[model samples]
Target chain A: MHEMGIALEIHRVCREAVAGRGPGRIEKVRVAVGELSAIEPDLLRFAWEAVTRETTDEGAALEIEWHRTEQVCPSCGPVPDRAPGTWLRLCPSCGGPLELRGGTELEVLDLVFAAEDDPPGPGGDEPGEESA
Target chain B: MSSDERDGRRVTRDFVRIRKSALAANDRVAGELRDRFRDAGTLVLNLVSAPGSGKTTLLEQTVRRLRDELSLGVLEGDVATELDAERIRALGVPARQIVTGGACHLESRIVRRALEEAEFPPLDILFIENVGNLVCPTSYDLGEDFKVALVSVPEGDDKPFKYPGIFRRALIAVVTKVDLLPHFSFDLDRVRERVATLNPAARFVAVSSTTGEGVDAWCDLLREALAAKREGRPWP
Candidate 1:
């Protein structure tokens, strides 16, 4: 799946986002994947697990905020959605052509990082850094 | 280790907000390349389609039709083999084959690499024939003036409807092998309607590379794009 490449790119974005933040575990990354972006969320999450498996971000959660590209009939304006991906062939209100609006988003919104006040350890501070 | 929230030894959790494109780097490179192409007076077209959709044949015919009038080049992307490049080279156009080694899409950086390494004499039009696949290629921008999605008659007309991602992204939707329309159940009108519903701005062009039918219109569109590029105008 191309989502593998996209996941690598997302990881790169995540790295850049948390760059120079000192030693820390990136606990989570939040991103918005649009319906029209052509990225499969499940596939991306699967790929993320692979990319971040042994890295600092291992077991990091990828929260996907899905967005829909709603279709708008040019003449009638903002038509309500019938389904997420399916579009009405023609404008229900107006006979004009239906155009899509703003759903091609593929962005990294934010991330959660847990910085170590002491030093780098075997595991993260959450799971096992403070072991028994 | 954290012994409650008492000491400074506690783990500090911070939420960092870095809102940016997943392809911010690729987008930056693509923007730079677009400027470069604009300054050099070249119309770059990223042709994307399913494999065996007559992209190579269409490119060959496109070159033959306008080669004398335009200095054209092709950066052919394939998952493997130089076969597509070889085919284009037979038509006397400078074709650089970019073997992605199983990468589904040609990223902007790869195009940048191809541009740096390859020598194409001041091209009027450079067609980056993307590795055959609709889904992945739709995500990566290779600094093309526009993307063209092609689907052959044999592939069925519902392809535009099926793959709305590519259809929505493409400025032009081409239906190849209309000559085979008699043999297939593909409906051109339905394709147009479906594509219009998804991408109202996507101009549809039906062509048959075998019959040379509608090739002129396709070349005309290219010429129009070239004129637009030179005039610093948008494609009409």
Candidate 2:
């Protein structure tokens, strides 16, 4: 529901980050969604479309990297791999109480854009626009 | 609003990869707000809970108890109304009411403005009474040194478990309206256990403004937090 606000933030940051790049369109953006961030990836994706419709990054892909919360078992130290959204309170091996360590992050990691290798000036060759 | 279905019912529009996080700018501002609060030598506490959690009442009681010893100000957030501010002003404390228009949560910008507008000389404590929403307010950081979550007895014991994020982020968890313990069938143990699971190091206090049961201890804890902030010590 609040994805619209998030989408606007993403747009603002991406625009600022690539503002100096030569005339080129953004191809993809990579964002990491932490397990405890309380964001629905699907909703965010939809919101992104609505926000970027007429922007420079129109039709840009949003690649989400899902981050799972890390649980630390008193006995085992760090649980290697656990299913997302599944709550595990005890260490499977020694039956020790597990502690939640991380995974509350909601941050944009990086953006990938197809910037012009050469300056888009008088001598530059025009590249045909392509859409997927 | 339904993206999955589109026969005049919904439409699914494909978006290109612009993979950016939507909260980058907000995070930056929030970071600055946090630094400002840390430098002010003030313990900013954001109080959050359900609608009738008695947050304003607790603040009124606290102001009456510690006004002489502490310089205090309050930032009250509601959809609309300066009534809470008036109530705090009646207690002779500097207070500002932040009408959030229709915002469900209080963000850093609003608190920053409230701080600028509030004229409290060298204050030791500032309490931000957040909008009475448990879910939306949990995600925002209003430049507070600590988050105090209130869970009244009538709201039931399962609230902590139901909204774990709020309880999880709180530095202090207070169970208010304990005067109704005789009338309500709340399992105290269950509430404590659930809150502990989400926030292992959180401090708990039970208080009733009407009966004055735990008011002293609650105010003492706040004073201790304020003292720790002034001395550059870690908060409890």
Candidate 3:
């Protein structure tokens, strides 16, 4: 599925953030997946593990926070928050058509790495290591 | 660090958790595509629908009809086959087929390349006939000015309600193959009402490419969208 692509993006972002930190292994990478984004978190996590297996971030934990798109009823205002994976048609409070508000987001937030204390950087590669 | 007193197997560090969205990169790419379309004066329409929704047929007829009035370029997306592209080219419009190579939907990256391969020409409209899928394409932004979702009569009157995500995201809902209504059990009003509920602002145009029915109004809608872009106004 498209989760591979999304996992690739997550890998790209994590790589950029932890680049040149000196052979340090990534601990976890946090990503937010919106309900309307058409991305399945389980598949994305599976893809992440497969993608990062040979990379520096191997065995890294992928923390996915699922976000829901708020569907506000024009007549009733905001719909009540329900458990994840629940679908609602009509407004529970008022019988009004629901309007989607948000939750179609997919973003890589931050990267946590185990930066080894080796006199400044990872393996002492200070900024510009070996060219080529 | 009162680990032993807390009766814990191992004291896990209380790391600060930050919640964020992952679509920032996609949004960035989408933003750039929007700018490029604006600069090129390209009105990109991402046509989405289920299989057999008459997307390619509509493009073929539209290209043939508006060949004299505007410069048209078509980007047809499918898992395999250049047949749609061939059909468009047979109409003499600048068209290219993007075989998604098993992808269910066309992402924005493919479209960005298609625009580049088209020489980034100054065009009136760029029709991106997305992979004939109702579910997947609704989530992916193909860098289009607006999305047009097709619901054919053969699909059933409950199509809109069953797949609200696509219709809700689309700006225009085109009910195609209306000529088949006589033989099909389709309620036009119920479909229209469902679509209206999802996207109240979206406009609906019912047409039949086979019978040449209601095409003028559809063509008029297309003209109005382009004209709105030309006048620096919001497209209807």
Candidate 4:
């Protein structure tokens, strides 16, 4: 349900990115979502569809690159045999606190967009709408 | 990563790299609020839990114990109703009720607005009782110094396993309504172990707001967090 808002923010970010780049409809957005990000990929994709409906960016794709957290003990490198999405309190070998690396990401890596109809001469942008 | 010509005039498909967070806007607002709270020397706490996790009850108990010792305020977040805010105000604490209406979770903007409306004195701590849901609330940081995950005894022991996202992100996982522990088969030790595995640094508290059991520990947690905040020490 809250993914709707996230989708809206993604749209905003994408459009802003496109505006800076050129006038083109967004075709696809590649995102990295981690396990601990508090997001469900399916729900986010569904929300993207709902939010992009009837807009110029309609049918835009939301490509999610899933990221998993790794448990690394300060004393003992990476803890092996632990299940994904579960944390280990202490290092099995060293009894030291384990620090998690990655798995909290919610980043937009890149986007693939197709050029729109009008290509403004050399600047790739309209005259009055130009950003100085 | 593939493209073709559209109309021979412009490149049909192009790729642009945008390395940024999807939650940048929300995180920015939360960060600003955090700075403001820090400048005011106030400790902010965000309480997350399921619908019947006794957040408001625990708050009532908190106010009763700490009102005389420290300045306190509450920003009550609910889908609808002034009920929780009224409960806190009835205890003589300055309370702001944020009626989220149909929104499942509270956002940072609303928290800022509620705090602005509060215009309270420099509070030792401000409790933002998030809407009764464990999932969505965890996504948004309310500039809280501590994220408290409340799980009631009736909710059972597997809550940490079921919603590991919240438990893993929380600074503390509190098992509420422990006075009814005799009636339920919920094992506290197992739950603690699970939380430890998920969040090694998370502190666990068994609280029964009804019987005022374990509230001393609860207050001690609060005081510790408050002290850390005021003294500029990093808290666990």
Model 3 Cα shift for residue A83 (angstroms): 9.1
Error of 4 at B61 (Å): 0.5
Candidate structures ordered by DockQ, highest first: 1, 4, 2, 3
State model 2's lDDT. Answer: 0.79
In candidate 1 the C-alpha lDDT for residue B51 amounts to 93
Worst 10 residues of 4 chain B by lDDT: B1-10
Stretches of candidate 4 off by over 4 Å are A73-76, A80-99, A117-132, B1-4, B7-9
TM-score of each: 0.93, 0.83, 0.82, 0.91
lDDT of 4 by residue, A78-125 (tens): 888778655666889989877777778889899987765454476554
Pairs of residues at least 3 apart in sequence or in different chains that clash in candidate 4: none
Q: What DockQ would you assign to candidate 2?
A: 0.17
Candidates in descending TM-score order: 1, 4, 2, 3
Please write out the lDDT profile of model 2 over residues B164-223, one tens digit for every residue.
Answer: 668878989999999999999998777877777677788889999999999999999998
Interface RMSD of each: 6.2, 10.7, 11.2, 7.2
Instruction: Give the per-residue lDDT digits (tens) of candidate 1, residues A11-49.
Output: 898888778978778888999999889888999999999
B136-194 per-residue lDDT for model 3 (tens digits) = 78777777899999989988988876776787789899999999999998989878877
The residue-level lDDT of candidate 1 at B37 comes to: 95
- Give TM-scores of the second chain, every candidate: 0.95, 0.89, 0.91, 0.96
Best by DockQ: 1
Q: Which stretches of candidate 2 lie over 4 Å from their true place?
A: A78-96, A116-132, B1-22
